[model samples]
Target: MNIVVDAFWDDEAKVWVASARDGIGIATEAGTMEQLQQKLSIIVPDLLAEDYQGPFEIELIARSHQTVAAA
Candidate 1:
């Protein structure tokens, strides 16, 4: 199965937040992108289905913003 996950950097929390947008009931956050990926690796499969042991694909979308001075 294929799963689409949306991720973004929380400015207030200073962390990367990830969630399954396809109604997989998955929401998680981590301090860094690597950490978030690790969390997703485990969380995605478990939430997909019970005893779900197979190859799966995960699509991650990241959105973030920054402030800079324009000269």
Candidate 2:
């Protein structure tokens, strides 16, 4: 099965963190982007193998500058 993974840098921890918003919403952290990707490769499969009956949809919102000011 195909899954989408999002990775971002966490300034507080000074590391890269990744999350799979679909399925089980699995998340992991690593010292670098490459490391985070590698960790996700291992994590995603293990998460899928779990007895989770998940087909969840996650909604992500990104606000424009104007929208941010209004909120």
Candidate 3:
């Protein structure tokens, strides 16, 4: 199984926050990008293993911002 992670620093709180779109949250104040990535690497698999089952499919629908705004 493969998953994508998005990580960034939270300036106000002074911590690294990481999350997978599939719903894993890894937050820490360890103070380095590598540390945050390592932590997330460990946590995401366990989180997905607990929540996900079997193969799944996703669809992406693209539309102009103006079209969405008009609706």
TM-scores of the models, in the given order? 0.88, 0.61, 0.50
* TM-score, candidate number 2: 0.61
Model 1 segments more than 4 A misplaced: 51-53
Residue 23 miss distance in model 1 (angstroms): 0.9
lDDT of 1 by residue, 1-71 (tens): 77788999999999998888768798999999889888888888887668466577888888998999999
Give stretches of model 3 more than 4 Å off. 24-30, 50-71
Candidate 1 vs. true structure, TM-score: 0.88
Clashing pairs in 1: none
Residue pairs in collision within model 3: none
| Model 2 Cα lDDT, one tens digit per residue, 14-40 | 776666655567877788766766676
User: After aligning candidate 2 to the native by TM-score, how far in Å is the CA of 3 from where it should be?
Assistant: 1.0
- Candidate 3's C-alpha lDDT? 0.51
Per-residue lDDT for 1-71 in model 3, tens only? 55555556666676666555555453344356667656655665555666776343222111212224555
